[model samples]
Target: MNLTSVDELFETDASREDKQREKVLDIPLSKISDFPNHPFKVKADEAMLEMADSVKQYGILVPGLVRTKADGGYEMVAGHRRKKASEIAGKESMPCIVRELNDDEAIVAMVDSNLQRESILPSEKALAYKMKLEAMKRQAGRPSKEDNYSQLGNNFSTKTSSDELAVQTGESKNQIFRYIRLTELIPPILEMVDEKQIAFNPAVEISYLTENEQTELLETMKQEENTPSLSQAQRLKKFSQEGRLSTDVIYSILTEEKPNQKEKFNIRRDRIDQYFPKNYNEKQKEDLIVQLLESWYKKRQREQER
Candidate 1:
């Protein structure tokens, strides 16, 4: 009866089982659910189609990460793209690394994983950062005076949740705050920001307006066929804060000429090409025009001096 050898054998078996838990398992697609409120979009564009083709040929090389739910189904934490590709590739099951993560942990992990993507929409980052920041704050427990100040006012002190998020995402703390501000905007205005019709700084300022004011501003913009400049948006934000912003005020501000605005002159490409040699490209023509302008200016100066 060698009890020492039996104990050693049991220990070895336990280690093997632990290692097995870390290995990939073929999870039924029906058993896996998408992460709740997943901010990232999986578009079925050319790239996705190419990915599906690759998956069909070689199978999924990287295993997806998932956690078991109470009802025994799995919830995907990462690899949303892979999951979709697998489905397109006609896979009944996907290879997954089963993990155990709580709500806050899952949120942080999900944000961290998706933020590495090459092309993320602005709205996605805004919502993801907001989710991660809230999760971080919850993990850290009760709100401090610093949280109150950051939420109520523009000033952010040392190492706020936004600051920590900035560190994680490689964005400036101010930029993170600006992105979060976008969440307050009406959906149409926010969508305009995502579409790049409204610039980031102007959109940030516009986010401070109330919903009714934002709708009014949108109408004014549509009527004028113009978006706000940074300075104009700042003025709008100021007016909104003071409760003085109205449709009339927005229209007036938008209609006012900007100090540095220039009247644009248009010349047809054919009209410009006739003045230059046949071999001259657009850049060469532009250089020649600039040279002629400079020469004319110098000649005028000489005549005035004489």
Candidate 2:
């Protein structure tokens, strides 16, 4: 006859209890704290307002995840937006599944859950990737009994935590590194990247500038009303590394027309203003000219295709 060992029976009982404790519970919003240094922004934009209305009518379809804090109350691992929606709906609590997770584990879970969102801004991705990568490195440092394996579940074949993250997130290691570099950018300049006023490649290149240099560049951009092109950003970075990126140098570079601008049709505003209505402002006239040129270019392209 086969007999179950005492340790086996005890382990089974513990596992069953753990599963039972995993059920959803109504956690008071007041008792739940946001995750430490949560990188994702919780905006009350149209999507969130719509979610609140749905929640007010139908209630949350999915529960959030949280874990007990050492001091008191629970810390959110995921579902910050749902919590916000619940608040907007005038609810006292939201449903959440409490879990047992250490700091590193929670960081990984929080980042993974938020990364699944349909729309994430570049600054959001930048901070999230940086946080997750750092957490992965910390987890990797813990000694493992298995050969060449980390607590993060990465095989040493991947070489580093960044490489492991690249494999999981489907971003090249270099690309991941570039995103991480964005965390170093000053807030105003970083916001420009998020707003798409500064293109991604140029923004990443600008991230290398010293904080003071970046601040100077921001002032220069405002004065010139022009952002850097990739070529100009490269030149700035080169000068920065050589310790010669002065405020005057920044102005000199920014005031210079970009390479793309060099090929643009040039006409004095007054020369074209006579073709527009007398009341039309400079901006209106310039915009009309651009629209007309775009239409002409598209028509030419279609003719060439034919």
Candidate 3:
């Protein structure tokens, strides 16, 4: 109401507007580079298509975060999916918040930003945890307690880097290490874990097998048409540690069926994938196969009756 009060209100409004303007910028997609070894995937799946459609109609409501690179342009710290969606939406540029961040800070920010997604593959979480844990250790300048790689089975104290990550991410320190161990698995085995062909617990135990032994196990699995259960995998690990594991030993262990283990028919995905549409997921392909099989069986029954 007074002259002084009016001037103060006007100054506050001007400062707020200036701050808002400084926070977001319309950055070109070409000028932005994805983060190095970004663990999160930006696939053109159903959700991504929906996001692209939304971006097309409404524009990018939430701005991406990036930091300036030394060479030139900007490095994306978050919002990789947004970038891809914008591209699909025929957008040349999207809103972003530019900031100054060191390598460690960038790594932490990237992991934190992506971890909240509803669906994350086991491999993605494994690599992301390893990267973020290493960055957290570096940021501290000295190892607190996680340096004891062999003793990860033991309960970690509050002073450890893993403990801090556990608190921040709501994953137990033991579970975090379990996920991190997955990084040591061979790509084929890791892919199996991602596809849900291998259970998570058994896969973690299998990670302890040496590369050669793992190769042997994979071959044995193919020959037997069965995968190792958790108990079988633990026995393999024990044999490997005792220095007695061999191709024969792996075959022997894998062949001994567990209680209630029934015979299973296995088919390599690549062999059948050619018959299905590109967008068909595993369930859809399976349903179609069952439908075809039922039709063939009914036709055979009619012919036999004749």
Candidate 4:
């Protein structure tokens, strides 16, 4: 990983002092404003509330980045969520760290900061990974014929650059590919994956399903009234291979609205036991045996259905 593309990698030839000055700093949030052109932040109502709650207790732990505005003020380069949360917390101003980031550095720094936090969600992580790849792309430009988005799938985007980036970053090509696959997952499904309700491999497999098919599966999960289980996913895959799996069929699998339990009691005592050896009567034994037989019959029927 010769990330040290020499000149390309550094963007500037500077000493330790310059690097130290470029490190994240804490400035008043009031000094920073939104980037009208920034594309990394997703507008998530739930996420906004989550961020607000985090700020209310801990305060802004990681300072935001800002570039000097043309209007003689600071405009946010990253940490929009933090900035928004500061407003929600009723703070008169928030802390910021100032910097001059060329487009690639700003994008990478923004993502790098968020990625360091312990509590980012799966969707957010997906976006973070995408941002990194794109930023790296911008810095390195596109690869040669290897840049096909299809054959490489998540393994490489704009194929021209993944191997080089992986070498530079010391991240494996496989991991990069997996992170990329996560982007294909729809929002609700991604939420499930984030929440740990869905395992990764199955989630990846589910992601392979068309977007419409994934939507259908989500609806089925609601109706079937059960969380999507590992077994159910395998069954869905089987049907998909058979070409009979549809949103409707998946819904039926989920709802599985059939009778749950029907039990019966039984006995296999010797015929001589009917005598009860004393006061037990013929009618009592006869009734007990009949009940036992009915229970056994029902059990057999249930077994046959399975």
Question: Quick one: best lDDT, which candidate?
Answer: 3
* lDDT-better candidate, 2 vs 4: 2
Candidate 3, overall lDDT? 0.89
Each candidate's TM vs. the true structure?
0.75, 0.77, 0.81, 0.56
Tens-place lDDT per residue, model 1, 1-306, is: 745676566677778687667768999988999999998888899999999999999999989899989988999999999999999999999899988899999999989999988898888888888888889888887373344312333454556776677677788766777787888889888889888999988988898899999999998887666789999999999999999998889999987888888764546565676778899865788899999999999999999999
Q: Write the per-residue lDDT of candidate 2 for residues 1-306, one digit (tens) a residue.
A: 999889767787768787667789998999999999999999999999999999999998999999999999999999999999999999999999999999999999999999999999999999998788878878989333322211123335537777778889998776777887788889999999999999998888898899999999999886556899988998999999999999999999887866557544446555665689989875787789889999999999999999
What TM-score quantifies how close candidate 3 is to the native fold? 0.81
lDDT of each: 0.84, 0.86, 0.89, 0.67
Best by TM-score: 3
- Candidate 3 global Cα RMSD: 6.9
Please give the lDDT score for candidate 1.
0.84
Q: What total of clashing residue pairs does each candidate reach?
A: 0, 0, 0, 12
- CA shift of 255, model 4, Å: 7.2
Model 3, 100-212: lDDT tens per residue? 89999999999999998999999999999999999999998866455543315566454778778889999877788899889889989998999898999899888989999
Pairs of residues at least 3 apart in sequence or in different chains that clash in candidate 3: none
Question: In candidate 2, which residue ranges exceed 4 Å CA deviation?
Answer: 1-21, 142-158, 262-306
